[model samples]
Target: MEIKGLRKIEPYVAGSQPTGKNIIKLNTNENAYGPSLAVHQTLASFDAHQLRKYSTLDQAVLRQALSEQLGVPANQVIIGNGSDDILSMAFLAFFNSAEEVLFPDLTYGFYKVWADLYHIPFREVPLSSSFEIDSQDYLVENGGIVLTNPNAPTGIYKPLDQIEEIVKA
Candidate 1:
């Protein structure tokens, strides 16, 4: 059986893994320093017995901790598996199918994937010749906007003033 939206999606391809012994693996953005001592201690102290039963899905403790640390309300702090998970959830929750979402031509590819999977129309605004995102370009009418701060591979970051301009428009 064929699905309607599946046909349009070009599955994302990750960078190839390094094969040779001297290769410096740059794919997946894994941490070079590995887990910290605090992380190791936390893992060592984890209560393995808790794994036997299902825990509540509410992340109030984590949310509260993050809120205190970040100086934001617990309601505003959402803990997720990763940035991708948070972005995916936000996109699905906030974007409307009737309107178009806007994003840069070169950004985290998953933004398009999420839009496609949710049947949310999205428009890709091209980056400038220097691979920088012009906030003015995003001022156009759009249902939602997703932008990478220090845009991927190119690493061009928009200043706060420019970001404010986009939000104000």
Candidate 2:
């Protein structure tokens, strides 16, 4: 069997870099400040012997710290490589061969791509004229609904209570 169609996919083009040494980087939303003092201290004093061990990506200590910070159970918390890892795991859990996923047209551009790659149905629900999703619209039909909290370039955030209600319903 010949593997084909891979070439048809468009390569993801990331944002550009700063031209000069003096240019303050603005494209990627990384922290301008250095790593936390605790993180720095931990890494600086990390034992070399531990490097020989094989631990799963789900490191317990980090997960426990995050769970404590979020006030949620470690089982409920998920750590990922980045936003894409979160998307991938969610799709894996919420979808299968015969399921449809719904997403807002205005949010994360990469969502539809993931659905396509996974062979899951992807529906683009248009936002209201003001470019915001009413919870009612998202609740209608979806195996899972994907949304950005503070939204995108506009940076508008919906209330948490409303988001919780939509997800629960």
Best candidate, lDDT: 1
Candidate 2 C-alpha lDDT tens digits along 16-121:
7767855666546756775899999999999989979877777788889999999999888887888788888888777774546777887777777778777777
For the record, the alpha-carbon RMSD of candidate 2 to the native fold, in angstroms, is 3.3
RMSD of each: 2.5, 3.3
List lDDT for all candidates, in order: 0.83, 0.77
Model 2 pairs whose backbones collide: none
For model 1 the local lDDT of residue 127 reads 89
- What is the TM-score of each predicted model, taking all chains together? 0.86, 0.75
lDDT of 2 at 135: 83
Candidate 2 overall lDDT versus native: 0.77
TM-score of 2: 0.75
